[model samples]
Target chain A: MTILRFDDWTDPVRPVKRDVIAKLPEDAGENPPVLFVPGPGHGATAFAEHWLPHAAGRGFAAYALTPRDGGKLREHVHDVVQTAASLPRQVVLVGHGEGALVVAHALGRYPARAAVLAAPVLDRWATMGTALRVNPLGAIPAVFGGRLRWSRRQLLSAGAPVEAYGRSSRLVTSRKPVPKPVGDPPALVIGSPDDRVVPRKSLDRTAARLGGAPLLFPGMGHDLMLDAAWTDPIEAILDWLTKELSAAS
Target chain B: MQDTPDIADRHDAICVIGAGAGGLVAIKNLREHGFAVDCYERETSVGGAWNWRHDRSPMYASTHLISSRPLTEFPDFPMPDDWPDYPHHTQVLSYLERYAEHFGLGAHIWFGTEVVSAVPVGDGRWDVTTRSTGGGAERVQRYAGLVVANGHNWDPAKPEIPGEFRGQVIHAAAYQDTAQLRNRKVLVIGGGNTGCDIAVEAAQQAATVWHSTRRGYWYAPKYLFGRPSDQVNDRLLRLRLPLPVRQWLYRRTVGLTVGDLTRFGLPAPDHKPYETHPIVNSQLPFYLAHGRITAVPDVTRFDGAAVELADGRRVEPDLVITATGYRARFEFLAPEILDTDADGRPDLHLHAFARKHPTLAVVGLLQGDAGVFPLAHWQSVAIARWLRLRTTDPVRAAAVQQKESTRPVGGWSRTKVVHTRRHWFEVDHVNYLRSVEGLLREMETSK
Candidate 1:
């Protein structure tokens, strides 16, 4: 989409769409580039740096966008939809965490060839419940007040990496609309049993609601992309998507 | 990992002919989509025409990019900023090599290999005959599909006039070095960029230099307002002005910067500046005015040691160089394989797909005044995606099939592909880009 501007104060993270980390292939004949959206508190590099080289290694032109300073959840969704719409070919939307929520919201508005949602925050309130159980001491300030001012120890205990946690908004006030099951281009749902931030069971609910099977990796952290065993889930998504795309075509 | 060469190992592998820029893009894109690909290059390496001294490279020693670096290079794999506005052939070759290595395209390519023939076996499969450039034996293999990116600059076209000249005659393609021109009077025939470049070059070394033209060309300066001329035009495209207005504006700028050629003995341009590709040269105008080079009329006939002009003038020179241009040659393919017009150029759909022989296709067959690298890339994209849709999504393929065309309308073509004389596959760069965008949009919406 067009350049979307947000008040820098709102999104203190200052999302920037920098040059991709790896060399991309030139394809006028195939599907569009992969537009990746990072999960909550994570920047474009958080998810992209982990898998962009791999995506390029596989022959796909993968790119990402870091959301700018503060805006409502709807604004973030709008930006993602517009970005996908702007591509030359039908884009493949791969989003993680809150970024996954953006991809889910983007589907009906903007048609994609396929979608991949990794540890999506489907229901924020339920996500808050998981946040409390993981670190109850830090949960009080986040719920009562408009701040998620948790220490690094609290975030680590809650299964979040310092890199992603640092960029996340200190407050969560937006109510996102639930997405219907994806059936048009189909979708690949991936998660890890050790994902304590969004919780592994939430991934099952999301997969069921989206009418797709859950691709789960056991003993992996919420930062599945950064974890050493990230390939397990990345390859799973890559494998399922290849077959699903070929079968559909 | 791409070294697996047994066709039986990959039942659905795509075979790409030529490992040049066009074929490189095709190979990489196909692999990215999960299709196994094998790229065959007759040369020891890639870069296509940009590679100097390659078996098929038409590049002269002084050959620099006609388009600027920003316009010519791929967007994702960009040339370094330190590079000149227009880089030499060596720089371009290095850039392409870096692209191949950066994308790990080495394994995908088979260096020093030639495709002897490719015949459609049946049901979207091809029986390809290839031979190693070394003393190795020939071998035949099966592939799911074939993409012909052999390029169109190999064979030189030599036109015949009424009288025959017994002097030292040569085609511009063969004039790789200028050492032979020293102390000799040279006459370069043709009005295209090659003719102009050599005429200007011969002016420096040859005793006397005369450039003959059948047409009048609008000469454009290499730069405008301190930026590459094409880059300035790229910025102008954002305004989205009407075609006539854009042409008029460009003509005015050219007139303001590079004055009338008639004063220097060159005839005024017969066609509008936009009618044909812009001949960008900074030295031609300077050399003509300074008396280093003389511009002459069309060569009506030739005599031993003498050349007669249409204007009733005659010139006797030691050498006659014909920069007449090249013809589209598919030396490896049989005549009946793909349909061609009277001009001998293939009449493939979108300048790519051959519907009758569904398993066959071609890339880099079309030309635009702008950067052809990007154009080749887009053509490769169309071919690769179409192959995927042909098998994966028939409903979408049906929709795409509806848009399948043999016309140059939606393609980046200026005149028809069958037009007479030089420039059969020329394209209006901006119009071509828009047309490609439309095609891509139509395909995306179909799914």
Candidate 2:
């Protein structure tokens, strides 16, 4: 019942130097900015390659964050919340995979304009179960408290650059109940049925928790931000955010 | 409600008085819950007490946060990581400015507009009258609810000492810079955090500094074990350790680090640690040891430029600064509505929701061991949720109102503190935040 977090008080999550890539539209609009948080292994370049520029070109101020500290989930959440606070206006949070969990944690703190969860890893047990079957060697390291190495096939579908498969980082998971966000901002969940890392049921559960059905991007892999069909998901998010923000105003 | 020629009807809109830290967050939370809000501020900008430019702000030039950044900043809008553990008042103002801009709260605030009165017009609605600071025609706006967050630090509580002094005497609220203290015999009265801060400043600038206190206080160091002391103390608070154990730990630590105050010719604290508001100043003790400040007993009377202490010692000073805290003043509303006590403090349930009116509430009025901004944010969130519940289900809202009326008073203060006017709203930060969280859970589950 007492939500006074002592861990945060005693051992606070200090800010770290994060790699951020930002792109502003030539003619910036009144729409809220969108901050992109990449999943484990991937950095800001995951979104910077296509999603940030594409979204900015579509009249939205876009930013992608690579939490270089690689600390606990709260640190990543702190990075997202602190970065979002620094922006000129309230931002829409877009988190992918492990980053989606960080965004959910941040949602409990920051009142974002909107939220977008792409290829969300809602359940670690379910995701690791799928990973074990799809790529056994990559999933074995995760079980031993090491970084999970995602194969090129696991990250992207077709026509993606070799560098798109990001460097591995230690992934932390928790079973605590996600805090109900203030304002209960509108949420849009996106994933592909053919993704290797996250199963369809996991995406559906994430959508159910956020009060929506997943917007399926067929024939795509786990890395929606680096997939050959990354444009579709980015466009869908920009369109949904535009409508949500306009309606709220 | 009917729209008249003069008074505008803000249909379903909530009216918030003040755009300082409390009012700004109130507006943000209410808007987040889908409520249109209009906030009126007397000053031209925000940052209620922290805004030094505001005429009534109590902030001096050298003021820094007593609580560390982690304990002080809002949960959502944290202070920048690069800032020090204790940031200056100007940094606080800029942080507030960043919060306002990030949340787009500037659009809803009416700068330089002061609320004249807020009269409850049945059914939780209020008729709020306002006037421009630039001296314009008065305007009245009717709203569905009212949130009074005009802040508690602006009004100075100048205590009466029997006789008048011919010297330049000013409350800490009016003491701005070193110009008032330079090369003069300065007597800083009261033992609160502000008093210790002013005394330290006087030690730096004044020719001779005499610090006066009615009673000895437990002086908490700004740091303990290489970290901010509040952060270290929070470990015990988080573990839900008993009050006696926590106090013992604090006393032991202070004894080891600071030794004894009596050894420095100051009175030993009569009360236990945590009995009074924690004075987080390490500099005061340093100055006392260095002979920059002479500790004196309480002043009994003022004779011309001379002051007589309780210990039969007389000290004549060129200027006197009374750092005796402040009283919460709600000038726009009737006193009886908030159940004002003899000490001019409001007796609202949980120091927030009004018992008489379901929609009337106040924020940022309590004194806590930690930062006030996070507490204000939580209070605003609870108020916003309660207001939202009122519209969706009036029956449940009325039940909550009934429950609020019966809720016990002073549950968050941990234990019995010294019964002084200054301790009227003292709360243990952990306990108070937990209670507010409990209230929020009740409202959400009932809905």
Candidate 3:
């Protein structure tokens, strides 16, 4: 439906040679591939640490993207869309935090088999306000077009001390309204009520846009894929995809 | 066709002709809308015209995309990020192959099965009779709808000259490689992209090359300002700048890049840049500048091994390749069903929905300044939405039918196109897509 995207038509994203971290099952099943997109400051390592291997272990072809540093939302979305197209089959887009925003935009272009948004920063202003209240040092720099840094306590409740990669990156603050996904792909929103980066209302709003309620994971932090209990959410996602896609086909 | 008891009853399925890019997307989009589709491709493989192996393909050895990859690829299924700006025909074929594979559309496609006829069976259904390409018994299957995407490029439009020439004359459709032009005097006719491409190839391979055109055309460069020219043009279009402004900008860019083409003995362009199907060939100008290509006026007559020009001159050429373009032809469906215009082109609503029948639609029937793939994709998606409306709310569908007739197709073109068979389906990409978006919004709101 976004065929008349003039900006995209005129200023298309240039192709950059980047690596995609992948973990394939011993015997890949007919299940759709799961492509995980990390949010700002997070590399593919965020998912490659646990979620990717776990999803692949659960009989899916799992892949993660290491998006270019300091890319805008459009560029990130283009990268995710292009990577998904290169996959053997339709993929389940699993986006974390700001990557979820990219996934939300990508859904308008890509007809994903299913979508999973983990602690998605759907409302940038609301997330910004929350960050300002709790972590002024990280949020203030981000306000002036600088990188947003996150503390280990902010990203994960319990895990090995957060890597430097866990710090927040530059944020996109475009005022354009979110585009409704094409084909209305079944979507699942996963978030933690105790997350410090994203407010609870933003999660509810995102779920509402997708015509669903967020599957809340209490006591978990902002980085669901990198959190100590990463397996819990990955299992929930795979289980939902198995049911929804089977019913769709 | 025999009415055998084995005739399949697929009332729930839609029958799509030609498993090219258009047909493949039609099948995928309809299936996305929860409609069962049965797509038939006469060729053994997919990619339609992009597949050189297909007998109906008009592809030649030097056939690279005139438009860049971003606009050329499907919006949902993009070409590879690593692909060049303008991919070659083989890469295009592989892209289509990958598209089919990724979407799992191959299962729906019936390869080597050519639809012989599609007769509407009173109701909103069609009795689609198909036969195997390798001479087999014809089989008829009943379907709820029919989509014509056989493509218009395969049917070559040979030009008419007064006298017969002794030299071997062939349509560009048949010109496959330089082997045909090597060591021979070549006369490349027409001012289309294909004509320019062949002329450039002939300059490299032939002993002498004479490019004969009826009128001079603006040969746009493939790139401008270090970016694909079409993208730059689209930016202006996206800004909704007035037609005059965009046209002025276009002329300025062309002036700076491909300065006065008449310096190479080519005539001044008879019309504005947007007034014709854009011929993007930077090499044509390069060849013309090097004196490898001699531009001649229109052909007046053919005099046994020599072609007489409009001016008082004659040139003898061993081979004549006419790239005069193609006409839209649908052999399977009755011509009346398409509601052809005075020019015999299918006068569809939005160049998609057949005015006469709600269920009958056509995809990839038009030519735009940009790539046709995205246009074709949106057209199919609109068709699926309309078909769904026809099933759910017949009243709204009827209202839509009435609205479609009031509007004209390709009305968003920047300038009045020169009246020619080639420009019949010409449209400005950004404007046309905006109109399509308008129609989609209407469909959504009405629902």
Local error of candidate 2 at residue B237 (angstroms): 0.6
Write down the C-alpha DockQ for each prediction. Answer: 0.05, 0.81, 0.81
TM-score of chain B of each: 0.93, 0.97, 0.97
- Which 10 successive residues of model 3 chain A have the least lDDT summed? A159-168
lDDT of 3 by residue, B1-447 (tens): 475657688977999998899998899999988899999999999999999999989999879999998889998998987888999999999999998988899999999999989999878889998989997788989999999999999988988989989999999999999988989999999989999999999999999999998888888899998999898888787678887787788888888889998998899888876888999999999999999999999998999878999997999999999999988988787888998756677767777878778899999988999999999999999899888888988888788777766665546443488888888788888777877877776678432
* Residue pairs with backbone overlap in model 3: none
lDDT of 2 by residue, B319-436 (tens): 9999999888888899889999766867787888887888999988888899989899899999999999989988987887777666566565444789888988888898898888
Which of 1 and 3 is ahead in DockQ? 3
lDDT per model vs. reference: 0.72, 0.87, 0.87
- Residue-level lDDT tens digits of model 1 in A1-249: 111111211122223343333337564234346788875466677656667767766667777777545655655765665555445455788888778887887674454668989877777776778878876666666777555533343223344444644323544345646644222567888877667677767888889877766888776666677765767777777677678767855
Where model 2 places Cα greater than 4 Å from the true spot, the runs are A161-163, B1-6, B413-415, B445-447
Error of 2 at B387 (Å): 1.1
**Model 3: CA > 4 A from native:** A158-166, B1-7, B341-343, B408-415, B445-447
Model 1 chain B: weakest 10-residue lDDT segment is B1-10
**CAPRI-style quality class for the chain A–B interface of candidate 1:** incorrect
Considering summed lDDT, which 10 consecutive residues are worst modelled in model 1 chain A?
A1-10
Q: After best superposition, candidate 2 residue B418: deviation in angstroms?
A: 1.6
Give candidate 1 regions above 4 Å deviation.
A1-249, B1-10, B134-137, B161-166, B406-412, B416-419, B445-447
